[model samples]
Target: MKIFMKILGIAILIAIGVGFYFRLNDDVLTGDRIIGIAVLTSAFILMPVFLYVRWKGKRLKDYTLSEENLKKMRDKGID
Candidate 1:
């Protein structure tokens, strides 16, 4: 399940990456109206991806920590 989620995330990331490529291809954004719309559409698909990857937890209590440091902090009553 985790791997599946990761793959889905990767797929979105790749789409965003491709969109970024088109978004930055400004020379292609010449006077042609059709080319401009297509490029903008590809780039706009990145908005959902940006939203997904950066979705934080609802509150501070749900944070995660690395195992080694979590243990050390646990021993020190910090976690």
Candidate 2:
């Protein structure tokens, strides 16, 4: 499922790029309108799905500066 979402997100991003490229060349008003809609749809779908797949099963606490983590950071001289 994660792999599928990743692929879908990549595909949508590519589609948006292609649509934008065509949009620059299109002179017809309706053609530009279609490209605009396609780009917006790709963006809306790409963000959430990609983020979900990227962050799925990851703990937010592990990345935060809790007491234990802060101590480790201090030990490493990274803080």
Give the candidate number with the greatest lDDT.
2
Q: How many clashes does the backbone of model 2 have? A: 0
For each of the candidates, the C-alpha root-mean-square deviation to the true structure, in angstroms, is 8.5, 3.1
Over the stretch 11-79, how does candidate 2's per-residue lDDT look in tens digits? Answer: 666666666666677645655665676567657875677777789999999999799999999999995
> Where does candidate 1 have its weakest 10-residue lDDT segment?
27-36
lDDT by residue (12-50, candidate 1, tens digit) is 556555555665776334434444544564457545555
lDDT of 1: 0.56
Model 1 compared with the native: what TM-score? 0.32
Model 2 residue 22 lDDT?
A: 64
* Clashes per candidate, residues 3 or more apart or on different chains: 0, 0
lDDT at 43, model 1: 58
